[model samples]
Target: MGTMFYGDDSTALHFEDRALAHLKVVIATKLRRGESFTISWVHGPGEQRGRSTVWISPSIPLRFVFDDPEPTTLNPRYLDQLATSANSSGGIQLIDEDPVP
Candidate 1:
């Protein structure tokens, strides 16, 4: 599991590294274009176990940590889905995609 630290180093949102790699591309693209949007996710049955969402803008500090050193290639279809959400007024909602081997 990898953690995405936002605002401060102490608090973080965790996800699989492969999932995060895909998110990084979409998120970076949106932020690079000065677009701000919300991204939301629900915890699994274990762990914190709740839904959480955040507003993403250029000004906010964001960091992504991955367990695996290598990068995962983005699935174009999934990337398009996420990118569409990022561009939408409602914003992006991170969903589980099949993990890369």
Candidate 2:
């Protein structure tokens, strides 16, 4: 399973993998371009949703850190699927010849 986050009506962001590679890509791009946006996720019980303003910037290294967590392996195939979807939605460009990257 994966998580999907939305920003207004035009922007939709999907974050999967414990590494959060795709999410970082999108956030970095926006922040590098001086754009700010919101991302919401469902956390805790009762289906409560929490939203946060993501501040993206090129200075932020591509890394994942959580207060307390166990490492989760990421499937390359799943990352490929996410890259494809992002490409289709104009979030990112499709890498050369590859269906998704």
Candidate 3:
């Protein structure tokens, strides 16, 4: 699993490594262009099992961490979907996709 650390404090969101990798790209692109949006996700299997959403902006500190050192080659189709969501009023919603072969 990978963790996305948001803000200056302990607001960290976790996702499967692959999904988070794709999300990181979409998020960085939006923030780089000074866009603010909301991101929502379904919670994982645990005490946090539910849905959570957050408002993301360039002013906040965001960090993306991958568990493995080797980089993941992202799927272009998934990237397009993610970017579409990021550009939407609903903002970025992470949908986990298998690696493109």
Best by lDDT: 3
**Tens-digit lDDT track for model 1 on 18-90?**
7788889999998899988898888856777688888877898999999999887778878888888788877
TM-score of each: 0.88, 0.33, 0.91
lDDT of 3 by residue, 1-101 (tens): 99899986488788888888888888889988999999888888884668889999899999888898888988899999989988998988877775666
Model 2: lDDT to the true structure: 0.43
List the lowest-lDDT window of 10 residues for candidate 3.
92-101
* Candidate 2 local lDDT, 2-100, one digit each (tens): 333333433433344443544545555566676544433434344347633343334533344333365555456655644454435333332222233
Between which residue pairs do clashes occur in model 3? none
Candidate 3: which stretches are off by over 4 Å? 98-101
lDDT of candidate 1 at residue 61, scale 0 to 100 = 93
Q: How does residue 81 of candidate 2 score in lDDT? A: 49
Residue 42 accuracy (lDDT) in model 2: 35
Candidates 2 and 3 compared by TM-score, better number: 3
Overlapping backbone residue pairs in candidate 3 total 0
- Residue 90 in model 3: shift from native, Å? 0.7
How far residue 63's Cα lies from its native spot in candidate 1, in Å, is 1.1
Q: All predictions: root-mean-square deviation over Cα?
A: 2.3, 9.5, 1.4
Which pairs in model 1 have colliding backbones? none
- Alpha-carbon shift of residue 22 in model 2 (angstroms): 1.2
* Residue pairs whose backbone atoms clash in candidate 2: none
